[model samples]
Target: MALLELEGVTRRFGALVALDQVAMAVEEGEVRAVIGPNGAGKTTLFNVITGTVKPSAGTIRFAGESIGGQPSHHVCRLGLSRTFQITALFPEMSARENARLAAQARHARRWQPFGGAGVFRQAAALADAALEQLGLTSIGDTPAGLLSHGDQRLLEVAMAMAQQPRVLLLDEPTQGLSVEETAQAVDTLARFLQASRMTVLLVEHDMEVVFRLAHRITVLHRGAVIADSTPDAVKADPAVQDAYLGGFA
Candidate 1:
């Protein structure tokens, strides 16, 4: 069975239709890239899957059970997690601390504001492991807000990884990064996903990054899925070429 599946998903924002009858499936331990031009409803798709945006119609299934109506926290508890387009972290806290907080939250513990930030057992170990995996061990002790933009993005990944999620959702993981930094982030992501055998659904505009890391690619246009195929197939698809690549070039 697929790790995640969306069937005829639809979401309307009053007068505007953000997503329309979208259907796709992502297998476990594979990277599925969702791509398209601006206003193609990529972010809206992420929000729907994460439970931040409710779908007006259709079913969302994860690991065989229905999750279409579940709230965000409930979805996370089911081992689904995501990072944002904007860096989302505790600005003043060290990277380790930020990850630790996520670990605690994922483990169903309430956030505590007292005592030594250094001794949080389960969360501490998970955070450390995630930092090491992301090659962020060197800056684990530094405040998240102070890292270079690329490092900040890495820290966000670490936080999501700390959740030990079954399915990872990355909303433009390399957004706002330099060319070199974007490549670094993609390399790190590819390595992390490979090592963990985690399923990934990423919304990205960078074709290089998407084609390099995604096992399959799905194209959305005007809030609907117009094409879904392997990287090479997607690149050659006349519909995809006409809707996106034609203009991307």
Candidate 2:
């Protein structure tokens, strides 16, 4: 079975249909990109998958089990993790500390009367490993708010990686980055995914990044899927061209 699957997923906010019968399947270790025009429901889809928003109809399956309507924390614990479009980090915390917190969330025992030093140490080690992998080890001591915007974005990704997830959901990861920063972010993310063999569902506006890293692309229009195909096929599709890519090209 595909690692992640959504069957006829629909989400509505009263009169507004944010998503309409959206169906998608992300296979193991594949990087799938979701793209569409503004208000096409890309973020809404992520919200539903990550359980920030519940679908009004249809089911979501991860690793062969149903997970639709599960709480965000529960879904996260089940090995699906997400990073938001806006970087979410503890501004006052150091990069290492932020990463350590995420790592601890995966392994810490809630029953512990007092936070154990051993657990903290283990989480710190994991944080260091993730930081090293992302080439952020040198800046691990820097405050998150003090880091450059691109570095902060990369740090947010490291925090997600620290979760030890089976699938990662990224929303506009390279948004607001400069040309050089965007290129760096894409290269760094691509290397990490390839090295770790991680499955990813990404929402992004940068067509270059999407074309560079995605194994396939799914296009959405007015809350419905318009195309799902390989990068080359998607680029050549007339419907996709007319809906979004024509202006992009």
**Judged by lDDT, which candidate is best?**
2
lDDT of each residue in 1-249, candidate 1, tens digit only = 888999999999998889999999999888899999999999999998989988999999999999997899988878998999877898899999999988877775443444355437778999999999899999999999999988898889889989989998999989999999998888888888788777889888899899888999999999999999999889989899899988443
Model 1 worst lDDT run, 10 consecutive residues: 110-119
Cα lDDT for residue 97, candidate 1: 95
lDDT (Cα) of model 1: 0.89
Give candidate 2 regions above 4 Å deviation.
Answer: 109-115, 247-249
Pairs that collide in candidate 2 are none
lDDT of 2 by residue, 1-249 (tens): 999999999999999999999999999999999999999999999999989999999999999989999998888888888889888999999999999999887666641545688778778888998888778999999999999888888898888888878998899999889999998888888888889888999999999999988999999999999999999999999999999998565
